[model samples]
Target: MHVQKHFGKQGILLVNLGTPDEPTPRAVNRYLGEFLTDPRVIDNLPGPAQQLLVRGIIAPIRSGIVNPFKPGGSTKLYQELWTENGSPLKYYGEILTEAVAKEMGDDFIVRLAMRYQNPSIADALKELMDAEVSSITIFPLFPQYASATTGSVHQEVMRLLSKEQIIPNVNMVNSYYEHPDLIRVFADNARDLGPMDQWDHIIFSYHGLPQRQLKKGDRSGCHCYADGTNACCSSISRVNQFCYSAQCHATTRAIVAELGLSEGSYTTSFQSRLGFDDWAKPYTIDVLEDLAKNKGAKKLLCFSPAFVADCLETTIEIGLEYQEEFEEWGGEHIQLVPSLNGDPRWIAAVVEMLREEVGSNVVL
Candidate 1:
């Protein structure tokens, strides 16, 4: 009698936040309908209230469904962000998926999915299941751990996997906010814009989360909302280990250190706050105001570290919108640092991270 060995390819699923399929109002409406309704994304409201608010008011108004005569504010921004190939979020995701697949060679199969749009997580998971991979590693593209982001992706993945009869060994990456390769990529991108000393100031802007959501994520009950100052979020600790704000601060520190930026030269702030509710404080707009009006700072460089790819937020909001505002506030130039889109170095870094994950797991 003779026995044969079995070998199987590992599955790698990369999930981004999401993007509208198209730049039109109706498309954005559809996209926001799915995205804003996620309980994790809008955890402050009850399910029924969340549904009603999002469907009845937020989505429709933002997408111009309520008043068709005037185009929604988001519609114009998406139009500006759109390219010949469509949404940069999805396009870059596709490019990344293909690059990772090729780099991993025959040993791995990589798939890309968006949490709330086309190329959904369901279809991507189905493909991996169909391939009968020995093990599955879910790598959410979000660098920081936020219940609304990495947490939501993990929950969705588990929900989808729960229906399968035979589940392979599953592993999910929580966050890589301080990954050396990730930090280096950001620093290198900044360096490419000539010398860093020319800029008067730098801003590290992460997407804002509601303050209520931040408090809700804190299970220890001793931090987050304990103080009104939010000084607790100044550094990472076991008490607030999973806090998004803390992770953002840590990420900024890492990038600043890598770039050899001195203290007081850079500031960390949050952007893209939705609704009137209180969000992470020291908002990016306020920071911009202080830098220009009070400090008389000009020629600022901004880094949106929370987002790995350039989307509406980075390109339109920071690049165009902020630039216009900064100029009005007596600033000379507000240079937007490029994101790690399809750069070969970024591709290599992602491959290295995936290999590390795969190597640590047991195959079949």
Candidate 2:
């Protein structure tokens, strides 16, 4: 039994997509397997079929997929990811939590947990429950609400609580993509890059999804169109209406307005395609290549807004693969503007997210 001690209040859990215990093939395989096999994470797809596709196919494909993006592949990319502390996500989570604690100052217990692998959700929740917290606010760190990402976290938390002997009052912060503070963070990133004048195009690349899964996500039965809507590619209820794309566009618009960039100077695309099914539209790689081939666009500035912290997808895939591909297509100077990992403004945003959701007195 989780021995109850002095009763306090609820806690805040900043849940993120976790990293493997180590950066190795075995661990990565296991982590990838857990992440890919989730029906909700992959969404709209039925069981055994998904497994046959992921486990049977994607499993063997991992080595090949990750090879070109690994640290061995790009030293500059790896350097950008490195900090004196550890993995960028883990480090930034700690930093944001600490900053949040600074802002909140111990009124509420603030903690961080990954959806899978080290600092597991169970461990974080157990700690909170041990403290006899009255409630919990879950901030899954995906800006866009996708069934696969935020929905996955929600279900995982519920699943964990269902198995628990005691439950705490919990409020989930589903999406803050439209939150002004978050917009400020993105704006800061864009401004930090100086003028948007040098770049030929601004592409906001999001994590891709199978188009069939996205279509089936239309719970409202009216989300099949391409326009950015909450009903697009999610269970269009009160919950996942604000997913990655909707938020991505909102951020893009916010940044564009902030920078006063021209109408056609910026665009959005999806990256990191896994299987051969229809995912989100206007794939990033295809867009990059086309921009180079036709528009004669050379210099580019790419952003992965779905991720607040740098990771393999952003660092390796986009910073390396996408950059290389751009250069291959005669495009030059592909600069992957770094994410707002622990940026003072981003730290402020995280703090604000906690304070607004839970209260001002929560632990940072």
Candidate 3:
């Protein structure tokens, strides 16, 4: 390990969930190796053993299966939406980082990394080390918490630094779904939707985790998986603590209050599920189909609160695929509010992350 102490600068390292190096099978395989094999990501498995299993078993199939972004020809209408910016997730992630750096002024260095692929945690830390930055704070860009997502990324980051023998006085933002400013951003999204009366349903769709994985939270009994039947989530002790479902429900409540909208005006569901494993139930496709069945949902609005920027899951899965599904089922229109990308108040939230984690005096 490369042990180092307090130095000239502090760094705010914003680590977003990664994308494949390119939208190809080879790239996806490489990305999934670093991603799915993490013990924190696929908890309960033995670490070294899981790594081997990932290499020997999972990567080959996952490569073909999990390419969130499909390659489309130039003639495809989807190609029309493509821009010089490429993937909106990476595009907005960089924009948000650079914008935060400008706002943070001097004395603080801001950098970003994907938890899985290019510009990785190792690279980000090495940059900080070269810049003589001694302290570091990691803001995993997940507003809500998940072991496979936020916690796993956090663990991998620590693992790389530990191997390098360079552990900075690191602080982490575990979850901020309840952050007042974040709530305001969601409120702004509702207003951006225009006449709310015209919309029959607002769905808060978060990324899903397998039920087994959700139950396997390291926090264990500290959370509420709540069988979703009885006081399961609330009435129980910490049993439901690590449950993403519970947190998504809480986010729905917070958003409702923020928008001054009443209950039943909205419902929360999970999206972007992979494989045949029973992920969190009431699949998004099913929900949209039901809305189509109801036939009165003239307008539909969906929000991906788990993600801060528009990514494949949000843009392609939710926006494109789900919109098509809604149309197929007969819903008139679906409007997806973009994430808090470069928004001024949202910018302040990023700054708040820096100030609270790295050090002080980070203002443009």
User: In TM-score terms, which candidate is top?
Assistant: 1
Q: Is 2 or 3 the stronger prediction by lDDT?
A: 2
Candidate 2: give its CA RMSD in angstroms: 5.5
Quantify how close model 1 is to the true structure by its C-alpha RMSD in Å.
2.8
Model 1, 135: alpha-carbon shift in Å?
A: 1.1
Give residue 8's lDDT in candidate 1 (0 to 100).
Answer: 76
Please list the residue runs of candidate 2 whose C-alpha ends up more than 4 Å from where it truly belongs after superposition: 1-7, 44-57, 60-84, 226-240, 359-364
Residue 42, candidate 3: alpha-carbon lDDT: 72
The estimated TM-scores of all candidates read: 0.95, 0.85, 0.84
Cα lDDT over the full model 3: 0.73
lDDT for each candidate structure: 0.89, 0.74, 0.73
Please give the distance, in angstroms, between residue 190's alpha carbon in candidate 3 and its true position after superposition: 2.2
lDDT digits (tens) for residues 72-171 of candidate 3: 2211322433457765667778888998999888877999888888778888888987887767777888887888778877787777778765565666
Q: What lDDT is reached at residue 8 by model 3?
A: 71
Off by over 4 Å in 3: 1-7, 42-82, 218-223, 226-242, 358-364
Report the lDDT tens digits of candidate 1 across residue range 94-181: 9999999999999788999999988999999999999988788999999999999999999999999999998888889999899999
